[model samples]
Target: MSEDEHETEDLQVEVAGLLLDHVHAPLLEDQHVRGVLPAPSEAPAVRVALGDRGECAPSRLTAYEIPLGAGEELRTSHDVVALLRAVHTGTHIYLSSRVTSVMGMDLYLVDPAHVKEAPFTTDDWASTLLRCLAHPSEERPGARLRGFLFREGGLLRLYMDSDEVPGVIAADVRPGGALTALLAALPSLLGEEWRTSDAVDDPHCRSLVDLTDW
Candidate 1:
């Protein structure tokens, strides 16, 4: 193949991986992501008094360099699909790089109290968590939710002390929401039990890739 063609291929591969991360970050961190599953039109949202906002609203959400070590860098669109499927299969995908950013999001903990309350299953609680983050606000446009880190065996605990609960979720509040298009493609990934160590078989995550648009 010609050098220019190869370079373009490399670029596409890198961009594809970025696309995956863009979507993966929010799903990992955002609370009650509403659409990961099919929601009914009349469903009651898992409502809680919005946390004491502002004082806790943070400037940056950082991920430990640890969990990131497990993410895989995908090269093809199919790889992206494989990862997305994991969300529905009781599996998860974590941000694979050291590039966690400052963004506004909604994140809540596994409120054990809410666990037994009827009609809504754990799925409803998780969906509510996502909706709170994705809900519209004035700080940004298009409700650009971004960089969500959970507490207790959460996605970004490497940077947090062992005592923090209900980690922060933030909005892109930045330029393009960077992964706006990508995040739109997946569903909420919030129902997993926290405070426990579990292993996931995620093919969509990797440390690096041989760039080829193949």
Candidate 2:
């Protein structure tokens, strides 16, 4: 899809909100959408506060500035994965405009990468589970997926049992692919760098990982 087509303001706000709720960090006094950007400039964005994660450093805090918008900003699962992969203490992203729409929810959500997987959103983890459990047949009905979603520490995680698989499957919210595994891999991915560096390690850096529900 073109950049213009990918801008989903509601989804962006929802994603930012997920990060705020689940990312393990100390929220600064100014971490809200309005708080992050004072009056006049106030726009839609997720201001995240994160704990430092260097294995050998003293305690410190970090905040991530993630901007939500359309085509001009982080537009793909790959972009998000790379952003998470590269952040140090935290990262900054800015969507050029604000979300002013007040539209109702859509009947279907299609992931750019996986048409078979339909992801839904709610205010938080508890509600997400309530949705999955509310129906024995799953909200999707005959769809082939029985997945429950939740957000925790920068990750939107999905724990599911599929009719096609004998064991449980743990997934992050994403288009189906290897990118889904990046969150759990952050520790080791950072570790490889830690092992070779002489600088005092930041534990936060070593442990930071985000998620999504499939």
Candidate 3:
């Protein structure tokens, strides 16, 4: 279907999964809602954290420190994925195919290009994303996707950043269509110019990707 429809579907799945996890593990009932993802449980009993006050604010732009259970504290975006793998051990976090439109980062869910069995080009990727973000909705005329980076594999990364040169930029570690397309476009996407190591080492980029059943 359309990108917005795909995003909505992905969001529904993510929320359902989160709710299911909570049902299985009461300790993780404290759900923090951030970015394009919808607000977590609103019941008074649930400890929910809404990252922004506005409707379409940037998704967790600056990193915040949060506990990863078991006394392990890590930054939200940077260390989350690695830490999640470490703590949860075997949980899987799926990613979408279109690198330009990663679920939860650019949009709230996995949105593949509308074309079937098609290898989406760069232009296709960018335009599809634009349409998805600007899709007309009942609440708002269109979406203005505010965030610049995505939270996948527990690390926050620039939305358009592509890894071409080794060690110059971090590659997409999350398994999804976006990673596949991004890796394919690495040669043209990444730059020859280099920056200091500190520029890429974002602390909030480190978040745990998976949550264990408590």
Candidate 4:
């Protein structure tokens, strides 16, 4: 084997590992419960809302799709500057999306009043989400657990908390109205009794690949 050929093979291995860690692992876990799923052919739309007191009423922002593929650098594509400008200090931001067959929801504990704010650019949702997911600073809180819910066969499966220590729950429910109603009622239902119930599983400590680069 030539030196150049060996280098190329090494690069291929690295890329494969990157895909397994960032893209394939999370979806593969869902597929274990849901069977085969379709690739994300189109970018998902983001829904944003302000968490007022304890009640959260979200509205649809502009529908912007950020590209995600191999050999592509992740950057912000949406007008995040305008959105951040409008957001007040100490406001809790809720971002949710239903992309293809996956429903993902997240919470950002925004503290814009602090000396250092969450690092994000005015470009795309991918960069924003990546920053929130891989945030380094401990002073400012980043993404919190709203969980990712997948539509599997005839059931809806939800995985909450960090990917490493996920709390999973499933139900024989479809998306749209039923799912929306369930999410709306989740706050009341996600108490100690709910966690201890037979429907919810004990935290499965599965370690996901650490996301280092975009």
Q: Which stretches of candidate 3 lie over 4 Å from their true place?
A: 1-11, 18-163, 167-194, 198-214
Which window of 10 residues has the lowest lDDT sum in candidate 1?
Answer: 205-214
What is the Cα root-mean-square deviation between model 1 and the actual structure? Answer: 24.0
Model 3: per-residue Cα lDDT at residue 6: 49
RMSD of model 2 against the true structure: 17.0
- Model 2: lowest-lDDT 10 consecutive positions: 101-110
Q: In candidate 2, how many Å is residue 86 off?
A: 1.1
Candidate ranking under lDDT, highest first, comes to 2, 3, 4, 1
Tens digits of per-residue lDDT, candidate 3, 1-214, equal 6554444445444333333322223212232233223323321111122233332344442121122222332122212222322322233243544222222333322111211222323333333333333342334421122233444433333322223333323322233235334333433533423321334444432222111110
In order of listing, the candidates' clash counts read 21, 25, 23, 5
State how far residue 166 of model 2 sits from its true place (Å). 13
Per-model C-alpha lDDT, please?
A: 0.27, 0.33, 0.30, 0.29
Query: What TM-score, over all chains together, does every model reach?
Result: 0.16, 0.29, 0.18, 0.21
Model 2, 1-214: lDDT tens digits are 5443334444454455434433343222222211121112344333333343322111233333333443455444223322332342133233334212112211111122321212222333333333333343434432122344444554444444434333333433432344324423422333232223321333222122123332
Tell me, by TM-score, which candidate is best.
2
Model 4, C-alpha of 172: deviation from truth (Å): 6.6
